[model samples]
Target: MLKTSTTNVVPEKKVEAKQRQGFRLNANDKYYASIFLGPSLLVLTLFVFYPMLKTLYISLFLTNTLGNTTVFTGLDNYVKLISSPDFLSSMSVTLLYVVAVTVLTVSVGLLLANLASQKLPGIGIFRTLYSVTMGVSVAVAAIFWLFIFNPSTGFFALMSGWLNLPVVNWLTSPTNAMWAVIITTVWMNLGFTFLILLGAIQSVPSTLYEAADVEGASSRYQFFKITIPMISPTLFFVSTITIIGAFKSFGLIDLITKGGPTNATNMLVYRIYKDAFYSGNYAKSSTEAIILTVIIAFFTLIQFKFLEKKVNY
Candidate 1:
């Protein structure tokens, strides 16, 4: 009886072990995973992946005024853009704008985040006030700044007249108009950067500060060595997205400068718009759009490769 029982148990154990060695998920897990991932996959395929592939296809064709394919042009559109003066100038302008916005936004946000992180009375109110711009849409913010920067009737006009100072045109001159757009973009993005860094700063362990205090570390020293390093991860994220946002900016440039005063503020996105609608060159526009996408992807890869290495976590 004992021998028969052992034989039966050993066979059952071997069968169970073999089943476990095979790679399989229970039916419930597969069902739940499908339920959770189905909509996102469908949406991405329909909206993002499909459109991107279609744009690549369209870029290879010559199109009529109605954007229908007229002929197969291959890479002629891309080669044409490479030699075009407007495209080259717009690429330069885009690089400048992206660099300016990313640097200034991150710097100011880090400064304000430190201020807001302090445990002072009514600090929450101050944080709320600073973050108010985050609630504003780009169109609304552009229009709001338009009112303030209007040379004849805006805030500068009102104040300059009162003080008898010569009024400076904020949005008309070529040099000033570029800076004006940059200022608006930075201000509009400040609230988002500040809030993200604020949370990162707050999450830092209190014991670290206490230890620094006991070691006679100065506030500046602690900030540079401890605070910055601990919050580097958030800084990396904010800087990356800020660069992308600056690259893709269109509405503010459209409303404020329209790439105007001799194309001083014209960036790649506005160039794409002009080619697509104003010039009625769908093939050229699609080619430019693909190039812009590649530029963005390249920079994003660089950031992840080099910049992300500095992040603490």
Candidate 2:
């Protein structure tokens, strides 16, 4: 009985020591994690969170040209924006632009990705060409397209002449300018979206395709069933980012259209810019910024809630 009791006591002490040692190791791990994450958290606080909060605060006040608050306006800026015809027009145009750009960019990107994923001769060169635009700067792209959209001295003009098509004014016309901007945006965004989807497609297991082939599945069947299901997560990610990018687009509108001949391409971001810098209405601009942020957040939440469920992984 004495020997059995001692054995039990020794085992209990050993277990206790182990538990204490594990606790100390966990605490040390947490300390190191905090140290590693501290700089990133600090940077996010300073650059992202602080500016967002500042923008929200400034949106509640009427400010002068220098962004100095002159009066507390509460929600007047938002209310005014909601009722203004110009603001409403801008909102409609922005929504249309976002939809057009997102859809076209994603569709074209998926098509290009599918082509690039094919095992053919010189396929590597084609893939490189497809993704080359990812390295192009937005300013350079806008300028290049600006010349391309020029009525007489541009690529489109030359094409129209050769095809004997109508000499449509690409930039000067209100309807055409919006489409022009949308096309340019779609082209500019295609490379990144294509690259992402291409990688996702390539990452799909060859075994799955072989199985489908052995099962007598057609190419279309394999693509729709095996390929799409496998790459759905990448598709969802690309779509979400593309929507957000379209919403925040300003450079193309600024450089190519400058909000266009009749405010046709005046997206929310450009509207905010005009209100803040061009018109010196800081309150309105800040309000627009907050509204844009909310709009983006709302769409992203919708995608996560509905679209994310469709993703295979």
Candidate 3:
């Protein structure tokens, strides 16, 4: 009996030691994780979170040209913005711009991705060409499109001449200016969206396609039934980012339109910029910034709540 008890005691001691070692290892892992993540956390706190909170706090006050708070305005800025015709117009334009850009970008990207996914001769070249814009900087893209949108000496002008159509003002006309900006934005965003969708498309199991082929599914049928469902998650992800990006679009507008042609392309972001930097109304701009942030966050939440349900894995 004593010998048996000694054997059991030895095993118990070994088990306890192993557990203690595991606990120590886990604790070390957590310590190392915190050490590695500390810098990133600090950076985010300093830059992103801190700025966001500061912007929110600043939005409640009236500020001077130097961005120093001069008076406690409470919700006056918000009230003024809500009642302002320019602000309302900017909001409407922004919503329209966001929807148009997001839709067109995703649609064109999905189409390009599908075309690039085809197994054919010299497909790699086409894929590379399609995704090349991903490397193009916004400034470069804006410059490239600026030349193209030049009313008298642009691509559209040349095309109009050839087609015997009257020269359509690409950037000068209020109606056409918004479309021109939208086109430029769609072109700029297409590459990233295409690459993401292409990766998602290629990652779909070949065996599933084979099974669909065996079942005598038509190409169209298979595309809608198999390919779309398989890549729905990527589509959702792409759409969400595209919407957010479209809402935050400012550089292209600044470079190309400067919210021009009678404030036709005056998106909320550009409005915020104009208010803050150009007009030097920091409080109003901060209010606009907070509103824009809320709009983005709200749309993102809506997408996650409704659209995420449609995502497959």
TM-score of each: 0.84, 0.83, 0.84
User: In model 2, how large is the Cα lDDT of residue 269?
Assistant: 97
TM-score winner between 1 and 2, please give it: 1
Identify the runs in model 1 with alpha carbons over 4 angstroms from their true place.
1-40, 299-313
lDDT of 2 at 230: 93
Candidate 3 residues lying further than 4 Å off, grouped into runs, are 1-38, 299-313
In model 2, residue pairs whose N, Cα or C atoms come closer than 3 Å (at least 3 residues apart or on different chains), thus clashing, are: none
Q: Write the per-residue lDDT of candidate 2 for residues 67-165, one digit (tens) a residue.
A: 988898899889998999999999999989988888899889999998899999999999999998898877999889988889999989988999999
Clashing pairs in 1: none
Clashing pairs in 3: none
Ranking by TM-score: 3, 1, 2
Tens-digit lDDT string for candidate 1 (1-313) = 5445546567788567556644345566778888999999999999999989888888999999999887898888889889998888888888889999899999999999999998999999989988988999989989889988999999878999999999888887988889889999999999999999999999999999999999999999999999999998788889888988899999999999999879999988898899889999988889989998997898699777756576543
lDDT score of model 1? 0.89
Please report, in order, the local distance difference test score of every candidate based on alpha carbons.
0.89, 0.90, 0.90
